[model samples]
Target: MRITVFGATGGIGRLVVQQLLDDGHQVTAVVRTPAKLPLTHSHLTVVTGQLTDHQAVEQAVSGADAVISALGPSLKRSTTGTQVTDRTRTIVQAMEAHKVTRFIGLATPSLADPRDRPHWEHKVLPVAAGLMFPNALAELQGMTEAVTGSGLDYTIARISNPTNKPATGRIRSGFLGHDKVASTMSRADIAAFLVAQLTDSRYRRAMPAISN
Candidate 1:
């Protein structure tokens, strides 16, 4: 499979790229700073560009089987307020133009899923996030809305707290309130789950909150 990845320089994003290469898939990574992405492989192609650049995004997505994004807003308040949202919109536009359907993007539990039942964490987290990181929360909410409304085969993997621990391959994915999910999951494991979605159809057009 040929894959194109956004946020390739990010923590989980880089791991996603490496995992794709290790799995023998041809990879194209689009990023603003190519130097930040240190991976080099015969099957990996690095394209330097921002996601907002339509032509650059299209060059990355033109012939890919799937597009996965580990992109998220900074925890700190964003000055522009809609950085991730804007980039996600650009990517969606590019994918629509190129007729690419499969899209896997990231979000937090703050983005609600219809399957989510009543839970305290689901209730409190979004409120806390709104008060603490309003810009980031808004950015993710907007990004989620864009992807969900894009009319593509999209899966938004919502993660809980992320740690730097190694991949366990033991991940729990489901709606937040209904599933017994841990509060923290390893970044490596999250990357594995995200990359695995390239072939997994169970979560197509569904947002599954994942944790350890």
Candidate 2:
């Protein structure tokens, strides 16, 4: 598969690229700074550009079989929260133009899934987040709306807090809110799951929570 990755320099995105390469897939890593991704492989092509640039996104996704996005705001409190929603609209347009169907993106669990039966923590946490980080929460909610309405074969993996630990290769994933209470997952495992979705149809057009 020829895959284009947005946010390729990010934590989970880097691992996603490496895992795709390790599995012998062609990878186009779209990023603002090429130097941030140090991995070099015969099958890897780095495309340097901002996600907000339509031409850049189009070029990166031109010949791709699938597009994966790990786009998210930085941890800094001062960051604006609209990047994910804004950039994803561009990606959806680009994908439609190029006739690419598969899209997989990373998302937080704050967005409501229709299949989820809320737990107490799930209920309280989102309310707390809305009260605390209203802008960020709203941005994520908008992003979710965009992807869900894009009319593509999209899967948004609503993940828990990601750690730097090794891949466990064992994850509890479902549309239910209480599938796992650990509320933590390793970045490597998340990458593994995203890469697997390239060919796996089990979760197509579904937003499933994933956790260790």
Q: After superposition, which runs of candidate 2 have C-alpha atoms over 4 Å from their true positions?
A: none
Q: Candidate 1 regions off by >4 Å?
A: none
Considering only N, C-alpha and C atoms within 3 Å, which residue pairs clash in candidate 2?
none
Estimate the lDDT of model 1. Answer: 0.89
Most accurate candidate by TM-score: 1
Model 2 — TM-score against the truth? 0.94
Q: How accurate is candidate 2 locally (lDDT)?
A: 0.86
**Model 2, span 47-75: residue lDDT tens:** 88887899999988898999999887554
**TM-scores across all candidates?**
0.97, 0.94
lDDT of 1 at 168: 88
Candidate 1 per-residue C-alpha lDDT over 43-102 given as tens digits, one digit per residue, 9 for 90 to 100? 999998877678999889999999999999888764456879999999998899999999
What are the Cα lDDT values of the candidates? Answer: 0.89, 0.86
